[model samples]
Target: MGSDVDFVAYVCEQAGLGGALSYRKMFGEYALYLDERVVALVCDNMLFVKPTTAGRALLDTVEEAPPYPGAKPHWRMDDVLDDGERLGRLLVATAAALPRPKPKGPKVARPGAPRKR
Candidate 1:
């Protein structure tokens, strides 16, 4: 089943980060980003944060699970929905530990393409 849009919105609001936070639909799931770095995923109404040392240290307890089949284990943040402060802190720490996103090259025009008049 696909993830719920309302759930995704709720998760983002709970995080309460001041960075460039956003999400993209991928294969019926959602990929959550913080400051252009992917921090978590919302799949089937569950929040799966990347397992980082910083994030793990912030949480009181750690629970690892896969967001989808055949995926690596992630820190299953089931309690974050009701705790905005915890969610925010987790996201901030995870984003800080993650490497900056690589720059994407500009798209090239097709060879021998006609120029506009």
Candidate 2:
């Protein structure tokens, strides 16, 4: 009986994925994010990641049920979830693609917009 924290830490440690990989509670489960981009998830001690060259490969090696049901197949990409190398590559790729957190600018009125009296 592994919890979200346990699984998340395990993934980061096991896969040796660098950068900040966080776990957020979503859809009543834990969503895995690499540099703030959702890349995978941990549910019921099962790992389900989005489709990627590495992620797909991970899914390809396993034949277990995916985290989310009503989905096409087991795992997100395929039915298997193995290969730490792929998982690491996937995490690195995802981390590299993460969008930088830009400072929010103040909203300004649109052109020709009426001024509030």
Candidate 3:
């Protein structure tokens, strides 16, 4: 089943990270980003945070699972959702550990479009 938008919004609101937190819907799921770095995935109403050294260290009970089929296991964060402070901390650490996203290439002109003189 697809994840509900309310669930995704609740998750972001619970993070309490303010403007830095955002989510994008993909297919039937959602990807949560912190400061432009992808920090977690919400699928089937389950939250899967990207595993990182700092993030793992903060977890009291470590759990791992894939957000979707054929994907690598992430740190399943069902236990941490209610704790906004811990969730914020983990997200910051994960975002810090992750490399910045690669720059997107410039758009190419479509064929048959009029060229500039």
Candidate lDDT (C-alpha), each: 0.89, 0.62, 0.92
Q: Model 3 TM-score?
A: 0.90
lDDT of 1 by residue, 22-91 (tens): 8999999999998788899999999999999998888888889999999999988897779998899889
Against the hidden reference, what TM-scores do the models get? 0.87, 0.55, 0.90
Q: Candidate 2 on 29-50: residue-level lDDT in tens?
A: 7877777577777776677765
TM-score ranking, high to low = 3, 1, 2
> Which residue pairs collide, candidate 3?
none
Which candidate gets the maximum TM-score versus the true structure?
A: 3
Selected candidate, larger TM-score, 1 vs 2:
1
lDDT of 2: 0.62
Select the stronger candidate by lDDT from 2 and 3: 3
Per-residue lDDT tens digits for candidate 3, residues 1-117, read 999999999998888988899999998899999978999999999999999998888888888888999999998889899999999899999999999999999989899999989
Clashing pairs in 2: 59-80, 62-80, 66-75
Residue 101 C-alpha lDDT in model 2:
56
Best of the two (1, 3) by TM-score: 3
> For all candidates, what are the clash counts?
0, 3, 0
